[model samples]
Target: MSEPALNPLLVELRERIRLLEGGAARVRSALPFGVPKIDASLPGAGLAYGALHEVAGGGPGTIDGAAAALFAAGVAARTKGPIVWCMTRPDLFFPALAQAGLHPDRVYFVESDKEEDVLANAEEALAYGGLGAVVAELVRLPMVASRRLQLAAEKTGTMALVVRRWRRPTEASDYGQPTASTTRWRVSVLPSEELPVPCVGRPNWLLELMRVKAGECAEFIVGACDASGRIDLSTGPAHRQDQAGRSFVAG
Candidate 1:
């Protein structure tokens, strides 16, 4: 005796149900940035659904590295959920983070002595879907490890930010770049533009947006942080003008 044949309409209905479930899963993924402009520049109008983002610093005193962390923190803050911060350095200043619009209460700091340990912990955190974001600071990140983290992020729908400190070799392999990430950004502190008023600092930054997946890049002068810990466009002048007495002489 043969088993009854499955109904074709029933099979089609089951496939549709599976597709809807997958769509819902994709929608559940977290975004890693709050800046509207930045998010617009990224694929999917945000970070990839589940992917690892790499932030590499030029040197020890590089403010770019700190900016990268703050960027992720800002994203987590906007998410309104707990953030897991894993780092090899123990000297993380909560106050500074607060100044960058990140609530210390929402952040969970984890310290690790080895880079590998930090990555491992970050992967674990990524596996836990409850986290808004996971940040790990390390000296080096292998391609294989990053791929694993990316996979885990997709499964859990958590955004992963990896801050890489300066190591012997500045260049990295293709895999070192988060293959799953919608975009990659390299931040650095350029000389702040001087304000017209004495003792007042100008809001300016040399921000470089490098897209790994799309292989595109762009540079822009962004406003600096203000009293409210937000980027204030009003703090800077609309355009540069010459003084009344200045001559329009050509060099």
Candidate 2:
């Protein structure tokens, strides 16, 4: 009788070992973000290729929220091949995304009036291989739904991003609930660098890695995303001016 109980435990142990092996493979094939300060905190020195990541606006539909969208777009721009972007918002400015490196030419947009449909499209897109990435904007993501998305992405080596958006401020507060994402992020906008010519500088963002499943939590304040979505390392002068903000400043 005791032997039967031990058999079940042994089987579970084997399953856990298999899952660990798969995770190790993902870490080996991570996409390098290229910033030493931020990269050091991640398991693979970059975002894992076949994983699900969540990004949220700083305050839901505020300027910080828009910054979060642009940040996600920049990451997508780094990927090769076509991308499927699903959302309910008709206000996505094409020119802005072009500047962030996600060009309109390579992106296919899917708009739906229903929130559930958006997630459904994302799951299907993630299951299909050979695409750059899948980006979905939604307000709620149940644990089961997220788990399905994760499995789908894992099957095809695709990266999926859940861009959380809420119509009301109260709804935004609910994002703290648990999900099956490999990581969760909150992007906040900060004042631009004051230039010598008295004009606005390139975009700046406060990227908070709220939860990271396989590595230490960290924050990165990335300065501009080039046409190819490459971010240079932080400059020396900026670090000296603010010690209170323990953020990684990458250009």
Candidate 3:
């Protein structure tokens, strides 16, 4: 008895599947959001290392932009090496990012005159493997540009953060356009947590994971990443009270 020869295309596909399996293992071991709901929704229970992630602020201004920037910085803070922040705006408050656990000493800022230039610089940064993460603040990112960034990240295992900003609220709708990012998120400023002593407490954020390749879109209200860059599920009055109690205890 003789066996038939295997198809060359089939063999190639099998090899690719094997490689994907190995890649999946790496992604599973990457950094987590610390919030079970968010982590569980991502592929391999964590954010993919060699992928491009898009984040957009809910409105225009320092506060709205800070929400999105801090979210990206929090994730970057968790990764090893220095963070590269590429932005067209020079008004980035280093203190704010430091409060998110991304200190200025560990951050390298790249200022560009235009949003396109910022994105271009970001792609170059992502292609480099030494940096921990690359954050690009851009008002517009076309599909071709995003896909290029995605490919650059894929090659080097570097994480790319696209912080989409807009001059107008209507301009933000561009986020709905197609992109090659692994996950697309909208980070909105949520009402600050109330303390029992009649003052504000830890900041909160409304995170909408609008698109995830391996998981369905989901929304969560989470305690903003603390000084250590960790966020947990923060919803309901009970949760707020618990946070207040913990703050008092720590104080």
Candidate 4:
């Protein structure tokens, strides 16, 4: 049977409607982790762009906090263009960030005494567009503030990364509160890899995906960020929980 010819007017009309309604024209973009096991478990097969994500330390220890910061740095490093980092504290070690592939040259730091000011600067940076990412370090992220940040990121297609910190150990419980972030992650320090030499090896981390929008929770015991900001799937027998043995099944 011969197929009927399609209507050009109908096709154009549908396209116009889609754009007007912010449908296909505004499709969600993704940043893949480049690891099949991890990417497969996330929506869009990767981290969604134009959205807000939260990362925190698993414990109150300094090592845990540094791990969380490095994790966020690795994420931002993978992206292109300049970055805006707003923090209440001026304690960021640039040399450590360079090791995670995020160089100080590409970053513009905004140091403020108040957390609210830091968040406001982050929101403004996200809305400015043409940037790679905006990172904000704050102790608490309220639902309303998160929603505002989410909207700003969506408008400019900028990735918003929130690094949650706490002065008091008890305040860590505040992360359980609801927010508009697309995903929440916790990074905990793990023992370093064993080496033939009697010296230290590359770091390892327990990367936990606590909450994800439209996705289940999951965790991975993987090699820590390298100089290029990429993490490797553990090949050691002790870390055989990776794709070689068990695949990443979102829980």
| TM-score, every prediction | 0.69, 0.81, 0.80, 0.83
Checking candidate 3 for backbone clashes, the offending pairs are: none
The pairs that clash in candidate 4 are none
Cand. 1 Cα-lDDT: 0.58
Question: By the TM-score metric, which is better: model 3 or model 4?
Answer: 4
- 1-251 per-residue lDDT for model 3 (tens digits): 89765434334533553464442322223578877778889987888888989988763332257788888888999987667788877887888888888899877777778776777677766664555788888888888999999998887787888888777677777889998999999876655777779877887766779999978998777788888878777643543222223221110
Q: Where does model 4 exceed 4 Å of error?
A: 1-28, 60-64, 239-251
Candidate 1: regions farther than 4 A off: 1-26, 29-37, 58-64, 167-180, 193-203, 225-251
lDDT of 2 by residue, 1-251 (tens): 45323223224433553464442323225777788877787787888777899988773333336777787888899987667888888778889889889999878788889888788778877765556788998888889889988998898787898888777777886689999998888876655655779788765566778999878777766675667776553332354222234444443
Look at candidate 4 and tell me the lDDT of residue 154. Answer: 95
What is each predicted model's overall lDDT from 0 to 1?
Answer: 0.58, 0.73, 0.74, 0.78
RMSD of 3: 11.9
- lDDT of model 1 at position 72: 54
Query: How big is the positional error of residue 120 in model 2, measured in Å on the Cα after superposition?
Result: 0.9
TM-score of 4: 0.83
User: Is candidate 1 or 2 superior in lDDT?
Assistant: 2
lDDT (Cα, tens digit) per residue for candidate 1, span 1-251: 99766334333433553464442333365353445665556656656646777664322324336665655555556553467788877766677677667778767787777887787778876765555677877665666887888888888677777765543444433324444455566554434557667774643444456665654565444554432345422234444222222222111
